[model samples]
Target: MSRQFRLPLHSPPSFAREHFAASPTNAQAIAAIDAWPRWGDGRLALIGAAGAGKTHLARDWALKANAVVVEAANPLAAPLDLAALRGRAVLVDDADRRAQGGHLDDETLFHLINMAGVDGGTLLLTGRLAPVAWDCAVPDLRSRLNALTAAIIDEPDDIVLEAVLRRAFAARAMTPAHDVYPYLLRRIPRSSLEAIAAVDLLDEAASAQGRAITRLLAGEVLAFEGDEGED
Candidate 1:
């Protein structure tokens, strides 16, 4: 007779405002977002690497301000109504992509920024890099974007990584020992998304083998991720 294994149900991770952990890595960025309406020039640039919670912070602020969120590439697809954005808070995510040569039209962005200024509306931008590093050709638009205050969210620290790992495990009803954090941290990439993916892979491996999560199991699981000799 074949043995049966009960598979765990998948649950989506929460991105609620209250659920966000405020650690040293992202405290400054969170503070900037919380200090909206009073921000000088009514513009802010929330910059961070992938999985550094820039989107989460932006979402939290948008929820509070009822902001209209749009991708940086939105203007390229069709005409963006600047009149509709008057007196409204606007969030433009992946702003760095606009600097990718041909992905975005600089004129559209320029007009939008100018209209926002005229309407006394707030603009929040999220990108991997600050405005200073953008490859924009329009001098006026470049100057305008650079004038906005920038809040940079740093890479994940040990505390954040541990919290991310714990949450990922908990979502799948897996109770990992405390040692699992430090053990996995030493081996996996220093990214929240990567840490979550590592947990997903490890949890699957453990369930398939009918074994408890341990340092040994983690090592075996990580080996499959090709994270060898890398941190």
Candidate 2:
């Protein structure tokens, strides 16, 4: 087989509502967001593991509420105007990572929570764990997290995972064998993150080896990754 150089291509993930694979798994979170201004305490955390569609849902809420979206890491480098955020919708993505990431300090985080909690603003935070479980240097911040309401997004079901896999491949403009989904679904861990990883590994293998992705290629890749038989 003739080899072909595969240049790295980047396809940014879309956060639009239409791009989201909505299902009962995330319906609770979606409903919590839609409940909006009436949210108990005016603050809520969408908690889930990676690729569980937290960011996508956050984006959808941001659009509907005209919420300001900011990475948890950006605050310390460029602090936001607390007064301006009052009575508005704000989303701080990856907020739980900030405590250990050294991107957001306890004081800043404390104020963010305080502002929304007491000042009539609506705040949304996304993370894999609940805010109360996060490691916080400030005792005050830790206390506030306990009062913060939270919504959980369960693991993606078969339908959602299938949609995720299909969309990921389509986004990369790669066409695998028609049997790819069924063959791999029962074999790999049932999670969107895992599905995307499978597609990524296969895509890389196909490009590097200059061959189309088939069950054989996929199996080789999965075996190499040791991600098989985890259904």
Candidate 3:
């Protein structure tokens, strides 16, 4: 029988500007954020897949711009009140969700876009889908989204993937031996989300077994992941 372990629950890794790993995949997106205030119409959209550094970049830009960060889960939530924001810059992560089905609400986001543009304040939105693809119902909202400058975080290459894997391990306070990184990199899919998830699972496995990360342990974890079982 296979043993099981309950993974500890924890908040996502806290974002910090210095901790972000930059590569060709994300340089353009980072550059766009760095060029803030100068962005045309004072707004921009960043599109990338999960774990593609969109949140990290958004958080860094928010810190630099003194912007308020809000998820697209529900724009009407307590903090999205325009009156409360005044003329502050705002960074909305997963803004694409709002486009699809009003996860952030078209009405509130429309107001936010206008507010962020007022008085040189800027708006930064991050999501997995491009603004052009947002299924907005409101005419004004559709036009506004269409007009915003857009950037993309491309799929990571080997170097960036390795960096991301290392960062994930570090976030859990586990330092994998030098060889462990290359080993996993060679075996796992070349995706930031996948790499992060693998690291998370490996960390929990190690924690449950009271073992340091090693070639054997990593192989065990990956082999278990490969088993689809009695499907």
Candidate 4:
């Protein structure tokens, strides 16, 4: 006989301001995003590893600039009316991912770039690497992309990692003991992405068990690391 399974309902939780921990590792990127209107050039590129807050910063800038955010890879089902974007900003996230397969052809991105140039509007592109590293067929698009200012978020320091873990836990309304952090620092992968994943898994397990996060829960998650270690 087959047993029926019931999946838990998933509702997104709202994060409090206290849940966003800032650190020196991402301070420059955050500052640049905060000073959007005053930036010298209209075009900006944010480069960073996964889970380095690139998407968060991009969204923040888009909201402040009152702009539209588009994915760089796939073509929009309906093209955005150029008139609508005039004087407003545009943000493209995961742009490098599009570059791998020559997905961002000149026809798609060039018009947007030209429009921003003529309208004095801001255009922000985010990716894992600089524009030069991206493969493009159009000479003009390549040159134009390279001309934009590139900013990168380096790996977080130990202090930042600790703060990140604490904040992530707090965001889920789970309070992890102070001691659990030190244990995580020693055993978990150094990559912020991994750290965030571990925190998420621990939170999920704790929520299901109706208990606070602890080293024991953390260990169970860490034990599955097998060959895929942290970056």
Candidate 5:
């Protein structure tokens, strides 16, 4: 038996506004974001589960606000500076990861919160959960988190999830049989991220076997996924 060698394909996701698919699940969040400086405190917390399109929404806001984007998973590696951000927008993505207390630097986040609230900048903090649910040991930071106005994006519903799958497949120029879509929707989790991952796995499997993606291939990949999870 020979092992197949699949090259590492780089498919960078597009976070452009046109690429974002809106639905009832995220309508309010998008509306809130569009409302912008209309927010009382010029600060907001965008909350959603993994693969819930939080980054897409955040990037959309950034485009409109001309905001600088940073991951809470990796805050400023250099010295923090907020002098020039006066009355501007800043997006701190994955802001709830407490690995380093501030997405990687708690003290810096604490300061950013104060600056945005009391000073001039507009800050949008994104996380997997609401502020109340985030794990932060900083006493001062907790209070700031509580003060933020939050916009929550629920995980994708059936319609949105289907659109995500279709879009993901289209992006790769791959089309499964018409019935494959319903077959997949029934078996996979309802999430934008999950749809993308499922497509990737199926793509890899099809490429390895030199076959087009069909219902049978999807079932095989899904079965493998379940087996891996059980292990």
Candidate 6:
């Protein structure tokens, strides 16, 4: 059997406005978040490709609103204690994933939606696609999800990518040199998830080696056997 490698977990970063790199990609999504508590229908959905900053925005919004956030994909797994989420805005990340394994059925979601409506609480659902596109077997849940206000996150442009890289490094308390930025821009994958993974790997390498991040080190670490295929 192969050994399982466990990555180290670090403390959560202190999020700041500077860390959020606004771009045309997320302009509308950002605007909708700013206009909170006015989600008149009590339901809103954020649709985007993977690594498109959906989770980041959801976390940020949850912090700002002091709302009780729940991952709809792994919701309570038992009869939900509505009292726990009632009268408080809820943010459900990866809402589409729920339909994958029947983890979130029509009954559960309908109850949550009804609770939010009755309590005047907001419900924010995030997914890779609009509800209509999800493989939801329950007709009622599918219809309800499709009716929510939906917003899509555009892929980041070059400028936004650079800014995101810088912010991600800062979040790790790593001050990557300016020269390294251009190098990574040319070498790394455009997906935000890949970018974040690179930053994380760099952080671990730098810490293990007790040296500052440099181009040579980044290149070597990125080319290691298992990591070679990763951008």
By lDDT, who's the top model here? Answer: 2
> What are the per-residue Cα lDDT tens digits for candidate 6 across 1-231?
111123333555444545677898889998887777777577778888876777788888888778776666774555456778788888877877874344466676776766665566788888998877876666777677667888778887667678877877887889976677876767676566667677888899999999888777777776634444433
lDDT for each of the candidates? 0.77, 0.79, 0.78, 0.69, 0.76, 0.73
Write the residue-wise lDDT of candidate 3 on 64-94 in tens digits: 8888888785646554567777677888988
TM-score of each: 0.85, 0.83, 0.83, 0.78, 0.85, 0.78
RMSD of each: 6.4, 5.3, 4.8, 6.7, 5.3, 5.2
> What C-alpha lDDT, on a 0 to 100 scale, does residue 148 get in candidate 1?
68
Instruction: Encode model 1's per-residue lDDT on 88-160: one tens digit a residue.
Output: 8988888778643343468767766665644569888888988888768889988888776899999988888
**Candidate 6: regions farther than 4 A off:** 1-9, 13-18, 75-78, 83-86, 99-103, 171-173, 206-212, 224-231
How large an RMSD does model 1 have? 6.4
Writing each residue's lDDT as its tens digit, candidate 5 over 1-231 gives: 111222332577888877778889999999989888776677889999987888888988888888877766764444446666566678888888744633346677777776674555788989998998887778888887887889999978877788888988887888888988877777677667777778888887888898889877877666734333331
Q: Please, what are the lDDT tens digits per residue for candidate 4 over residues 1-231?
A: 111122232344223333444678878887777666666567778988866767767876776677788777665435556678777788888877764334355666776777664566888889988887876778888887877777777776677678777766766677887788887877665555566667777777787888767766666645634324422
Query: Comparing candidate 4 with candidate 5, which one achieves the higher lDDT?
Result: 5
After superposition, which runs of candidate 2 have C-alpha atoms over 4 Å from their true positions? Answer: 1-9, 74-76, 99-103, 117-120, 208-210, 224-231
Worst 10 residues of 4 by lDDT: 1-10
User: In what order do the candidates fall by lDDT, top score first?
Assistant: 2, 3, 1, 5, 6, 4
Candidate 3 at residue 223, lDDT? 70
User: Which consecutive 10 residues in model 1 have the weakest lDDT in total?
Assistant: 1-10
What is the Cα-based TM-score of model 2? 0.83
lDDT pick, better of 1 and 6: 1
> With candidate 5 superimposed using the best TM-score fit, by how many Å does residue 102's alpha carbon deviate from the native?
6.7
